[model samples]
Target: MRNILIIGATRGLGHSLALQYAKKGMVVYATARYSTPQTPSHGIHWIANVDVSHEGAGRRIAAHWEEETKIDLVVISATYFASETFEDLHWDKEVAMYKTVAIGPVFLIQHLVHSGLLKKNSRIVLVGSENGSIGLRHESGGAGNYGGHGSKAALNMVGKLLSIDLKPKEIPVAIVHTGYLRKENKEGFFEHGGVVKPDEAATALREWLESFDMSKTGEFWAVRGPADIKTAEVVLGPLDTLPTPLQLPW
Candidate 1:
């Protein structure tokens, strides 16, 4: 049985991945800051009050995992989003978001890999967004609401470097950019085809992870696809394809 470790599994994609994996009889170790109280099942395990942003936090998690089993699939599914423009965005807040979306996962993965808690044929998946694609402009001032776009761009680089580092170990890494989830659409980024269900996104992620070829490492896939999102597009064209979502490495 594959052991999957999901970081930041409180809600949305993370929560859905945890629940679905547990239902499928896979061992799921799910961590979150806060989660709705629920009964534990045979396959579902929970670790609460895990503030991933804390220094040395990854080591703590690794230490905890040393007690039982090694993980086969590591999912860094935690993300933070904001809608402030460059002039209006706070530097402190942006840095914090960067840590949450970028550095936190880097540290966590570093620790996990170093702990030797990963088995052969292991896979690492980082959840990211299209906003992070470099120099890709949104025609209608599209995803520029806040720093979500820029932070994602930073994550792209992180994903690339991580892939390079992990490749030698035969551990394939993939970064997926899921469509804007329904719950996060309070701002109506969904007026265009942005209405994919949370469950759908999670299912896509699971499928991709299961079917991914190690040779495809460092690829960024758009979940819930119309296959519309393109990689290596220097210029993001008009928003004609309202929800042609993309994922960038980082």
Candidate 2:
């Protein structure tokens, strides 16, 4: 896409995606949490104080958009991971998690659509997680991290509803498990059971997105496929049986 807008572009996959798009001479609009957003290099126009966890986060983006041209591809990659055990939990963190991962997207998309910043052919990609899938939970059987997983689950629902709402406009919305990401500065894919580096996940997803369209709207997917998922074989099918850009169950 020529015009790329990436929310939560401070670090991890968002940062890498922004850079990749900018390097391709595409117009990139990225956001950071604080007023003084980092400008690592030229081409990426960073918006300030656009915390998704807060209300009206999309307004911040619109305010800084000098040219509110229709965005071709919009990737919302903001996620807050809060570890919670059966013995310990934080209510505030969970609320923030939901606001950031789930609730925020609703308003963000609404703003984009209402402001005429998204076209009928525009694509909206939400970064949800495989851990969010209730259908896959029976096989994985992991406990705790309620907020982390729950928020993503909520995001899946959000994406589904957004897809339906935008259907009349012919816009497409989809959620994806971006893969178990290692630290942004990490090297090769190692440890944490195929925890991939940010750039690797970004590259795989960018390539796969070329074919994504209305045919795949309202669906969930694993951009890099079942290779990095722990419960993929048991929950879905044999590793070899699954395709690389596999569509995931809700």
Candidate 3:
């Protein structure tokens, strides 16, 4: 059975992926930022208090799986998003976003690899956003989102650099745009027609991972294809013309 570790697996796409993988009988390890539940979900091994924003988070996760020879896949899906316009920018929020989205994954992956948790042929997937793409930024709607977009762009760079460092070990790193997701609010959930459910995003992400290999390392991809990207037409042309699991520009 495959040994899969998903960071930030408590909710969103990470939660969906962990549940689905466990249901398929894979040995799933999931991280939580808080204490583990008294009765955890079946088939999932929970690593509690593993906050991706901190450097020690990866070391804690690595210690739990020291006996395992190798981890087949590791996905860093932890993210922090704080809405900000130029006028309403918050320094604290931006720093938090940068720590979680860009800086944390680097140290976490380093710890995993150095600790022998991730070996040759292992895959590392960093969950990024389409908004991170510099090439796709057009005047249509490229304003605002200072922290979210900027940090994700930093994440893409970090992932690419990691791929280069790990290439010798045959570890392929992929940065991906999962999908435009719906936001859960106090009132309820709200989303546009193009926004996909977390489960849908998880399913698509798994499919994309199946085809990912060393040759595709250090590349960015849109797992939900180009249809859900609102600005795809303005930057890359008509969405209908693009293929599913499209290769994204940095």
lDDT of 2 by residue, 62-91 (tens): 777776468899999988888899899999
Task: Give the number of the best model, judged by TM-score.
Answer: 3
Model 2, residue 181: displacement in angstroms? 1.1
Better by lDDT, candidate 2 or 1? 2
CA lDDT of each candidate? 0.71, 0.87, 0.90
- TM-score, one value per model: 0.82, 0.94, 0.95
Clashes of each: 9, 0, 0
Give the Cα-based TM-score of candidate 2 against the true structure: 0.94
Clashing pairs in 1: 83-145, 83-146, 84-146, 132-152, 132-153, 155-250, 156-249, 156-250, 159-250
Angstrom error of the Cα, residue 62, model 3: value is 1.2
Error of 2 at 143 (Å): 1.7
What is the model-wide C-alpha lDDT for candidate 3?
Answer: 0.90
- The reply for model 1, stretches above 4 Å from the true place, is 34-42, 66-69, 143-146, 184-193, 226-250
Across residues 23-113, which tens digit of lDDT does each residue of candidate 3 receive? 9999999999898757568999999999899999989997788344689999999899999998899999999999999999999999988
